[model samples]
Target: MTTPLLGCDFSSAPTRRKPIVLALGTADRGRVRLERLEKLESLAAFAAWLAEPRPWVGGFDFPFGLPRELVEHLGWPTQWRECMRHYAGLTRPQIRETFAAYCDARPPGGKFAHRRFDKLAGSSPSMKWVNPPVAYMLHAGVPLLLEAGVHLPGLHAGDPARVALEAYPGLLARECIAQRSYKADDKARQTPERLIARKDILHALEQGSTRLGLRLKLTHAQHEALVHDASGDSLDAVLCLMQAAWAAQHGAPSYGLPADLDPLEGWIVSA
Candidate 1:
């Protein structure tokens, strides 16, 4: 049987206007087909979705763990689950204050402590609290994945059938578009150029031209929907879906993760 795959574009705080988007699909051979898109307007909804009993391998666009240097420096727990649990107990303001202090102690151009995988993936430091607020994303999302009993490879052991891998869409996006901004959260900045960039990305995926070597099979309407959604939430979800497909193709235990992947600082799939 072809295992179902999910690519999630997450939000720490989701509402009707900017909900979490999940691209649902499956992979066979080297082809990934877009089965549908699901939106959750709240974390509770997302949690419920995760709790569903099914077999799936998901590529999640959120940091699954923090940098070991930052964690150790902060005197936090070193074990992956213990560290995350300790992190989950803190308020957002407390997290912000603590992380801010850590940054303040560092010199210019070297503020944020990063996971080793961050350098390879070109991802924002998981400790970042502003701009993208990926720190909060790790706090809000990872605990839910843990509570949902999903397996997070190279991090914590859980259900084998329901696997989750850390994923960054920008890694794939940069390969196709090379630093072109293809998305804008602010409606005023959603330019025609960005739309064209999105089109180009979709074209590249459909042709199986990206380094992951997976073809994206999207319906005409799905292609149009992804291109027109200026926020790029749907497109990001699809990007993650393709990554999940790639991971699934590898099959079983590691699911394309590096043998040396840090248990406390989970690696991104295909990074």
Candidate 2:
């Protein structure tokens, strides 16, 4: 059976307002075909999905680690497992308090805690809002991935049939739009211009405009559905779709990934 390529738009606290949405697709001869798969309403439902047997490679849009600097400064364990253990032990309020204290000491523009990976990868600071709102994502997403027991390639070693990679749609979107704002959940900013820009970006990806040399093919209705969703949920899922395409194309080893992710440092798809 051909392995499926998966892309997930994750939420730390999945609810009616912020459900976990996954995009499922496959690649053929360097082209990707994407469609929405399932919208999970609760973490329990999402956990069940992860446990089901499947052979797939996925690009999930969530921070997998923190900046190494933040990890070290907080005196937290550096190894992925250990850091997660420490984090998991703390209550949400405790975590917020700890991180808040760190933020208090740092000046604005450096408030949110950061990891070394943030600097090295040129990724968004885990605390930034405007660019990706990843800080909230990190707080909300990583713990669940760990709990789900999904094998995170390059960070943790486990099942090969299910491979997880830290993915950023922005990494791929910027390739096509280059700093153009294509989405704003705030209705006030969801102008026709932004809507048109999103459509154009989708078209460019469909036509294989990126360095990955992969075109995303979608039905006219699929295209419209993605555009109509004002929350950027569909767009984020598509961005993940591209990342999954890239990972599958690169031939990431089946299961059994490396097990040395820095908790404060995030991971990236191997080049």
For lDDT, the strongest prediction is 1
Q: Each model's number of backbone clashes?
A: 0, 10
TM-scores of the candidates are 0.99, 0.87
Per-residue error (Å), model 2, residue 187: 2.3
lDDT for position 246 in model 2: 81
- Residue 9 C-alpha lDDT in model 1: 99
lDDT of 1 by residue, 207-232 (tens): 99999999999899999999999999
Q: What is the C-alpha lDDT of each candidate?
A: 0.95, 0.74
Q: Give the per-residue lDDT digits (tens) of candidate 2, residues 102-130.
A: 88999988687655455544577665433
Shift of residue 4 alpha carbon in model 1, Å = 0.3
**Model 1 steric clash pairs:** none
